[model samples]
Target: MERLITYKLPKFGFPRLLAIIGCWAYLALPSQADISLTFGTYAADKPTETVRKYRPFLSFLEIELSKALGEAVSIKMVIAKEYEHSIDQLANGEVDFSRFGPASYVLATKKNPDVEIIAMESQKGQKRFKGVIAVHEESEINDLSELAGHSFAFGDELSTIGRYLSQALLLSAGISGADLQTYEFLGRHDRVGTAVGSERFTAGALKESTFKKLVKSGVPIRELTTFDNVTKPWLASSTLAPHVVEAMRHIMLEEANASAVKQIAKHGFLEGDDADYQLVRDAMEDSQSF
Candidate 1:
């Protein structure tokens, strides 16, 4: 005959069982806050226009990030009145992530050591992009040397291509700020292009992409010369969760997502690090006036 003895199961108090259930519930809840991506006014367009231009790409990023992270994500267009403000937003945690021109990233790193470069923009399959000095197609000014004594326009003073690289090129040609009859900051690349195209300014400096785009759109301007390449970067606040950052990096590098990236006027994105922007730091240190 089988043994008749049977063991009794342990029982927990009501309070203990409730505690266990509560712990399980906590584990099942979502673990992250919504993400915020901030961008500066890189063009002359109004804030609404800037938002409109970026909406498609931002929407794509939002959807992908949410899907990957299992949490909601959102874009917060900071629309910085000045380029420096964008850097400030990233450094101070006003935004979780941001896209910075090379010089701005360098300056932001200086201001806030917590700034990190995670990815860079690529266009035409090249990770590097150049700055350009532009003038009216019919302008008599034919060379950087001729820019002396002529009124000049610049985009944001903190702009890498629009101001710093442009300043460096001018310095190489012996045209210092004092050499210009006058110089003004128009606050955006498109404004600089429009100002130069209309002959409102003798010359201006802007990103090669912006210059080319303006020309393609029938703006009457020509590139006077090109400057050294600057590595454009997408930066994240160090305070961001590691997983969130990795998710963004992954999305950016995914070849299948190239179409989404193209909405931002880029061929794609590449892994980037702070060291990649050392040249920008060197350029900024060398040209402080801009």
Candidate 2:
């Protein structure tokens, strides 16, 4: 008589074998979790212009961040024909992150609550800059109040120093919207400076950096005056993954700490948070009051 043979299959049947194989396959795949970061900057120059042309005055934060992240990063230069269009792109997540002036950041955040404040440029222990209005030496405009009822020029309506800050300053001086007979957005800061210099506008407002550059380029400063100083220059963006954000912070700090980066960025951007932007946001609120 043949002995009854005992045959025991493994506890895991074919289904279990398939499950094990799937798990192993998943583990072997490459992780695409690393963020695909995109960055943009306000183009104070022409859209067609190469960013390399103004490398001296331009911020290289994007390049620095790309190096720090240990991954590929794309930097898109934006020359917004209208401030609204730029803000709309950012709100819809067409752009992952950006470095915006105070006014532009406010407009973007108003549309998308997901944007986050990551960092800002600072000097003398302050993270603020202002809008300065000026014109050619020949122009008679002397003060913010004097701009009323005159042809006013702005760089970009979304510009913190160009439009919002300048407008806020005008309002503070009791200049009402109806007081201005004409307003123009020249699109670029250089154009704003040139227009004011060429007598195209009675006065114009721009970031101090741009103003300084124009002056350096031989635009006479005698033509311009500080019509208003409403907000500071701040950097901001939409929220990113914690690890990604940390990676960014680490890169900035490390780069800044190195003497070489200081040469590239002119100055290192300081660590910043939502609170650092509060003052900027408050100034923006004040701007709306006008």
Q: Which candidate comes out best when scored by lDDT?
A: 1
For every candidate structure, what is the RMSD over all alpha carbons to the true structure, in angstroms? Answer: 7.7, 7.7
**What lDDT is reached at residue 212 by model 1?**
88
Which 10 residues in a row give candidate 1 its minimum summed lDDT? 36-45
100-159 per-residue lDDT for model 2 (tens digits): 666677677779877766566555345655556877867666777787788888777567
Model 2 lDDT, residue 155, Cα:
75
Question: lDDT of model 1 at residue 172?
Answer: 76
Tens digits of lDDT, candidate 1, 62-172: 899999998888765666777777777788877777777788888888888988776898756666777888999999888899988899998887888777777877887
The pairs that clash in candidate 2 are 115-238, 116-237, 116-238, 129-232, 134-224, 134-225, 135-223, 135-224, 136-223, 137-223
- Runs of candidate 1 exceeding 4 Å displacement: 1-44
Candidates in order have lDDT scores of 0.80, 0.64
TM-score of each: 0.82, 0.72
